[model samples]
Target chain A: MKPVYRFDGFIFASLIAGLILTIMPLPDAINAWRPAWPAMLVLYWTLHKPERFGLLGAWLVGIAMDTLTGTLLGQHALALMVIAFINLKLHLRIRVFPKGQQALAILMLVLVYEFLLFWVDGVAGFATSGIARWLPVLSSAALWLPVAALLKGAMVLARRA
Target chain B: MAGLKPTDVLPGRGPALGTRLFLLLACSILLMVLDSREDYLQYIHSKLNIVVYPIQAAVDLPFALADWASTSLASRRQLLAENRDLRRQQLRSDASVQKMIAIEAENARLRALMDTAALMTDRTMVTEIMAIDLNPYRRLLTINKGSSAGAYRGQALVDAFGIVGQISDLGPLSSQVLLISDPEHAVPVEINRNGLRTIAVGTGDAQILNLPFLPNNADIRLGDLLVTSGLGGVFPAGYPVAEVNQIEVNPSQPFAHVEAAPAAELDKVRELLLIWPGDVQDQ
Candidate 1:
């Protein structure tokens, strides 16, 4: 039987990796295309293990992201909270979907995440207009499958250990 | 399949999801409002930034390793060639320094005769950039120096070419610099050719700055050099800021559509010099 309350170092490691990836420097042209790793990680964890990773964890991770990226404090926290809340509410339905449908669901979640960020940016007076603002949503969706697979593989390894 | 899973029923024990979400949302809004409107959160941010410094260093490790490997693995012949090129450049600059010293002495004597205050040389320290903000619109850079090294907020920074930016946030180990090319940044500048003063505002593109206040009949022209007038007391006087590259005078518009290219390579700068402008001593 799976240990219901075992400490999961794998989750912590994955979260750290996600934060690192979010702030990793890229070239100007490709920077816009970088995926929103924190949002994806929050969605993934909250979907897979809502009991452990809930709104509080998501909010804390978002705050870390805000600090790392130097955005207005709480900007990412608000977005990630909204995404995690939605994922928690519908995880049962989403979990049963096929891989393609799962990817589509993840796409929608990422879109909502980016939209919240864009809206917050507008309200904070740092609004930037262009296709660049929406580029990460598409990239995050495309990369979701591989990222999920990688995280699942790590989890499996951790469980075996 | 009909048996209810423990995981499904377990999460409902806490405060309802809606209440938790609403509370978190309210907390976020409060933090944002305080951060944007006041300096209350800056102290907390600076302390929390210590936790973030390691992650930034780890992210920078790959690039740092590449730079180290390239330098350490270079052939002797290549090193010799580089050394020779640097020596030649140093010699050229040394000759210019001699001329500059003579001109400076003459200028000081003239200033004394005119009863004007003497110019003081700014003190500067070199710092390497640790990270660049991923958000293209923000244009912030994190440098290795911080309060430990006398870095303070609003301190001016420059590269080898010209004015780069100013320090906006300070941590114990590192600080964030707001680049002059960020859309929100503006500098007071005057034309080197005619002393026609105007404000050079950032356009979100590192290569371009807009002079929105220049009138149609302003004595600004293409290829004109822009230098800091030191009117704002934030930047030192006579620092090269940008060179006017485009000018359009419209008969209908009240202000001419003028643009200039930044003197510093804002997008590619890997190192910057943090400057402390010398105080003008009163007689």
Candidate 2:
């Protein structure tokens, strides 16, 4: 590991990959279950590397996502900043938790993120369908371990280099 | 030479979380308000979308590759069958067009006799849909045509059957279309049975539209076809818009509740025609 910390390209590359997956088209039934990949990735990085990835980085990623998805600007940014803050504060405790507990924590955080989105959308007079937006929490929970492992592996490789 | 020191590299604490969250939240609220209420941010949105363009292109690559693979792998028999079907359809359409030419002349003469302005027949550009908005609340799709292809805001989109939607926003290489089935969209339509004019608004369902303001005594009936009335000046006149499927008149309610199925296959149409009105040139 380097003596001094720096912005890791691997983090960004993973974020971009997450961004691509976030916009990837899926069939109708599957689309409703689409995980909030970008937000999830931001959470992972912020939790694992809070010194490097924090609220501002998460905000930028969210804005990029807003642009990619053509949602109202700043909508996703707000939700992601909130998620990042929560993760930053709880990263130590979260890092030591069992996988099942970690998944539960993620589920709660993601639900909060999605609820903020739902509330913002409502306040902005945009209509949303019933219950489908919540479906992603299950998907995000299911994929948390695998995604965490992948990001952990990437980070390990990046540090070694 | 040492073990992975994850916690050592990442300090347990960073900036004051509350203050940063508050500031970011405030900034985001400001952005949301400005973005929703004004058109000024559109310049920024368009410019920022350039950054997003590559992600969209990359995401679409797999689907494109799959399409190419399937087409290449198709048997000669399938290709021949498709070609034969298209040829037959083209010939039938050609015969119809020949008849339409004479009918169009007669229509022009009648309009001239009546001193009414000639109907505006638009020049159309074919565009393929690239992506659909996954948000259930909004009905929108991105099409390959954009300002580069002479697509402009308010340009009408149509499938083979009828009006599909209007161009809501455009980027350099692609444009977003707001479908007629979006709750925010309203089309002025005339009933084909009796020429009764009314506004049909989307009910937030792709398959249905609501004729909300029609009076209880309106002569609309089940299965009556509704066509564009040309009142909006967005959609061209005389294209089929919807078919009346249900009518419910409540004595207590001021207006009848009429529902119609949109004529255009809003959910299934993959290709669209971008219409430029003949009278108004693209700026």
Highest lDDT model number: 1
The true-versus-predicted C-alpha distance at residue B98 of model 1, in Å, is 1.1
Candidate 2, B1-283: lDDT as tens digits: 1564655445544446787788889989998999888686877777776777777778777777888898999999999999999999999999999999889899989999999998755677788877788776778887877777877778899898888999887777777889999988999999998899999998778989999999888898999999999897888889898999999999889999999999999999878989877655343
Question: Individual DockQ of the candidates?
Answer: 0.66, 0.56
Q: Native-vs-model 1 lDDT?
A: 0.88
**Candidate 1 structure quality by residue, lDDT tens digits, B1-283:** 1364765547886589999999999999999999898688989789878988888898889989999999999999999999999999999999999999899999999999999988887888899998888886788888989899988888999999899998888888988898889898999999998788889999889999999998898887789999999889888989999999999999999999999999999989888999989843343
Pick out the ten consecutive residues of candidate 2 chain B with the lowest summed lDDT: B6-15
**Which portions of model 1 miss their true places by more than 4 Å?**
A5-7, B1-9, B279-283
Which candidate number has the best DockQ? 1
Which residue runs does candidate 2 get wrong by more than 4 Å?
A1-7, A157-161, B1-17, B279-283
Per-residue lDDT of A1-161 in model 1, one digit per residue for the tens? 14544434667778889888878887777899999889899989898878768999899998988888788889999999999999999999998999989999989998999899989899989956888878888898899889889888877776787
TM-score of B-chain for each predicted structure, in order: 0.92, 0.89
